[model samples]
Target chain A: MGIIVLKGYMIFTIVLMIVYAVRHLLFAYNRAFGKQKLYYNDIYSSRMPKISVLVPMHNEEQVLHYVLDSLLQCDYDRDRLEIIPINDNSTDRTRELLDEYHAKYEFIRPLHRDCPDRGKPAGLNDAMAVATGDIIIVFDADYRPATDMLKQLAIAFADPSVGAVMGRVIPYNANRNMLTRLINLERSGGYQVDQQARYNMGLIPQYGGTVGGFRKDLLLKMGGFNPAVLAEDTELTFRLFTNGWKVIYANSAECYEETPETWEVRGRQIRRWSRGHNNVMFRYFLRVLVTKHMNWKEKLDGILLLLVYAVPFLLAVGQLDAIALFFLHEMDILSGWWVLLFIGAYCSFGNFAPFYEIGSALTMDGIKNEVYLLPLIMYNFYFYMWTISLGFLDAIADLITGRQVVWAKTKRFTK
Target chain B: MASDHKRQIYFARTYRHLKANRAECALFLLLFILPCLVLLLLFYDELTWVMTNGAVWMIQQAGGPRAEISAGTFLPRLGPAYYAVLPTTQPDYSLILGNLAVCLGTVWVLSTGPRKGRPVAVYLSIMLLIHTMACAFFLLGKDLMPYTLEDFSDLYIKQQIGIWITFLVLIGLVMGVLGRGAILRRMLTVVSIMLYSFVLGFVRYVLFLWILYRFSVLYMPLMFFALGPFFDFLYFVAIYAISTNGVIRIYNTKKKGDWVWA
Candidate 1:
């Protein structure tokens, strides 16, 4: 009873902390990072460089056209732009779509990188190696990027030291269902509160594995898409930071993509991502952090980024064990203390953080009470997916066995 | 001189008006001072008798006032540990009456309240007081005051003492002033009750232990806070009752009409 109470108490603490965050830190994010106060003329400066768009696709026969159309409407200089569509071992009519787009547009350069369709990272590397542009922008198939996304990203890179600029990926069909709405909210909170907070705190912002821009030279210099891990994009961006490179976040520059709607699909996707990113971090996070070039701020952020996904596994197991021993009447109080402590921690810390910002944003988008669906979030997070365990195991195995975490191209939802 | 005298008279009038009708204020002072007075004024034997009588009353109310029972008779029953909602066996009349009185008391407090949030505070404070009182009564009902007042072992005496302390603290807090002034203090009292209930969180502990002892972790949430549906159902019934009986009575009385068809 004491142990269970202690855990319940700790978790309750976390709940309080999260409540505090909601009350204090998030009331006025607009005030803190509010719309940058930039003048209209300042936004459309002629000095904005043309960005090269790179999208590597395989077996995305269903929704490639909408993506291409959205890309074709790029709000940058059409003549200076390049869109390299790398085809890698598609058994579907994906190659046909690329060729059809190629015939229609001069900027759509269809390239076959099929010998190793191992993943998007390999295709990106193969295409990126031969790309001829000042700035490299990567997008996933089924992506419907905002027209002015190029301008938003290009403005961020004017800082010169910015190695990459990561954009937001929201579910294309946000108003689909209760589940999708919840997912949109989660994404908002992560992007708006978590990532945005990290950005403000001078920490390394996590680059989602899609719709990110990189300095062409800097990307290759840091070894573009090492294909050694599944989340090659995150791997490279973090690596760039470790080597004295900085990333600029372009929140307004968004690419709408498909989110896994069902639990089965969502679980598998999360598992793969967890495994891949953990592999990526284990490979270089520590070494880069300790490196002579990296700053303390970046190093600390790197560790936080690494520690991000370990809780689900820890929480699930700890909760189950505590439940068992507490009933069996034998386990020591110290045995299940971490689980309690973790609950206490997240609930507390979450209060100050914008963990629910995305959901809040969707609410702002007229999706009300999305914030109150915490029980649903808990149900899905704890019961359905154990992403952290998958992450840890993958990292260790990749370390010991030297197995490459395969890069999986995310399919978009435009069609 | 006449002007100064008139001004002083006005000030005195305002002060007197402010001082009038402060039931909450009187209650606040008494909560702290009365318990100690009770302990000090009564002789030791009388005090013990008083304490035992109160415990006995609580035990009897709880329907578990055992008398001179052997250890063999206790643990053998209640069987294995399990989280079960044993049926509520109180008579329907008592439940309805107690519930009515509680509701009427709440309504009276709220209706007479001066501040905007005072009514809600009063309602919440009463609910919390009932909940905490029920908990303390049950846990300590088998103690020396009630246990030896009935018959249990000499063991668990210290725990009973601890339980007694929690009860006294709860009593003082529930009835005590939470903040400055009467209405704010009352509001604070209500908030404090809900806050304290949350902090205690023993309900969760007991339920989880029951789940672990009986079923499995898979059913833990279902067995526990799955009260969302049940609470909603209760709220519906409570609404029906309030609307049918109390609200109608209050409305009729205020309107100067036949308050009760019955």
Candidate 2:
């Protein structure tokens, strides 16, 4: 029975890996060749919606000025635009810096949070309560949006159905080191291909936490951002989709952000992401299945997207299972057509962003020479597997023990 | 203004996209897929012979143990092929206990030390986990040990052939469908990658044999599982990247404005 279970699991893992491989391949092919579904870029209105740009800062003194300065330079109408930099219990010079910006610009508002509940979601909840805009856009303290980014992101809300809008993120310090370069490739593949293809296919396009915006009234109606949820972005995405609202991807609405330059920082960042994403996954997996708002395709893609963070953990366990089966001399698992399936799965098992997907994305991005760093993502496979698996365990523990989800900030290397 | 110019160039190159050309894709399929099938059919025996001879020569130079090359058939329909045969060493009681103790000690050190979350620590722990499993299997379930050294060599050669075939097909698919370049450059990229794979496979086979001959068969699972074709694909991707870069460079220089804007 034990042997049967291992073999069955091995087969199941292979099938799952193959399904992801095919899904990515289709995404790559579509992004490369298929007619792209356009964003609402050309839909200009004389009367634009009132917008509040929220910059969430927590001890982000090193990188706070870049985002604030960029936001000041944006071309949005001064009467309609407001910048709120949420100072969430920041100990560094962040509060002072925001105050300086607020004194200089009438539109720049600084919200200071001295209370114990400190995180992006809680800060956002507080900021949203006082924000005087119909649409609320969010950017991390490290992000430097382009002068027209606000207009591009806000234009999507002109359509009543678009609950949220996500823009493409380009790494500003991609050439810093090998880690940053690899991350740049991942971001390229993720946004340029994955998100764009999902939008093109009329599937679910996730509203990433930053470089994105949503209807403030809609979120407020849904009881504001959940302070308990670490992945407020993913949770809000599912909430909006399952409630019949759309999240649109604007590929042209590009912004520059810093990526982690060191392996340790990247690992912690990935682990935190995995934990938060998995928590959201556990909460919404069943809801996506039963939600009447989503069609069959939307539900399928939604479930797959939710399970994205969990794949590395599953693949890691699958590796251990393969070893156990090998020790048990259960080589019969590789018989006949199983050999092909096993080999295919082995090739596809690492990095959720497959080589072809990234390669095609880089090609489309007109990025030359950076594609050479594509192979190094193999090392990242092990890194992500172990770290994400730990995060998965953390999430499972969170569910069982009802542990408080602390927002672990990613170490900024901008200075 | 300079940044704006740079942005314009970047967007010009990226925003202008390419439509799928069925003819180019078909040609790519034929270019790679046909050659791979042809090579497998005509030169499978010869390729295996070269790999077998290379392994034997390397093992002899190492002067660790006596190595012999023997002919064997994996699937009867595929015909017979030459493979390296090495004497298999079963782990003695002392060896098993010693390795197990070492694995446990390392695991303890890693878990307790400051290197707990480090990648190197994680990598070492994974390697130790496999070695520990092998030690346990040798200690508790020695009778269930399925593969000997010869069987492993046979499987390695068979999988190496499969790897080569798949490499060719995948490279073809990626470069043909996703890649933008002149046909000659694309073909050259495929050839370069195929050559790299051939050399890599030979060297890795010899290295695995040398390790297995010097050490016991206890490390067979580690070599097969950890340091196998997966690592080979890493360099394969690297070569593909380099080639793709070359294609992009040429396109940017010559046909910069030819992109079909989305």
Off by over 4 Å in 1: A1-43, A320-342, A346-367, A409-415, B1-262
Worst 10 residues of 2 chain A by lDDT: A332-341
Which one is best on DockQ?
A: 2
lDDT of 2 by residue, A171-223 (tens): 99988978788888889889899999999999999999999999999999999
Q: How high is the TM-score of chain A in each model?
A: 0.83, 0.98
Model 2, runs deviating above 4 Å:
A336-349, B1-14, B30-35, B38-46, B53-77, B80-82, B92-121, B139-144
Q: What is the lDDT of residue A35 in candidate 2?
A: 81
Give per-residue CA lDDT, model 2, range B116-184, as digits (tens). 766667767887888888888889987678888887787787777767766776677777777776777
For residues A1-415, what per-residue lDDT tens digits would candidate 1 score against the true structure? 7566655644543444334433323322421222222212245677667667888788888877777888888788887788988788888998988998898898899887657546777887788777778888888776888888777776777776878878777787767766576577667656644555456556677777567888878777766766667877678767777777877666556578878654445555666777876776677766866787667867765775664554444444544544344333322233222333333334322211333333223322223344444333433443232444666677778889887566555534344
Error of 2 at A96 (Å): 3.0
What is the lDDT, from 0 to 100, of the residue A162 in candidate 2?
A: 91
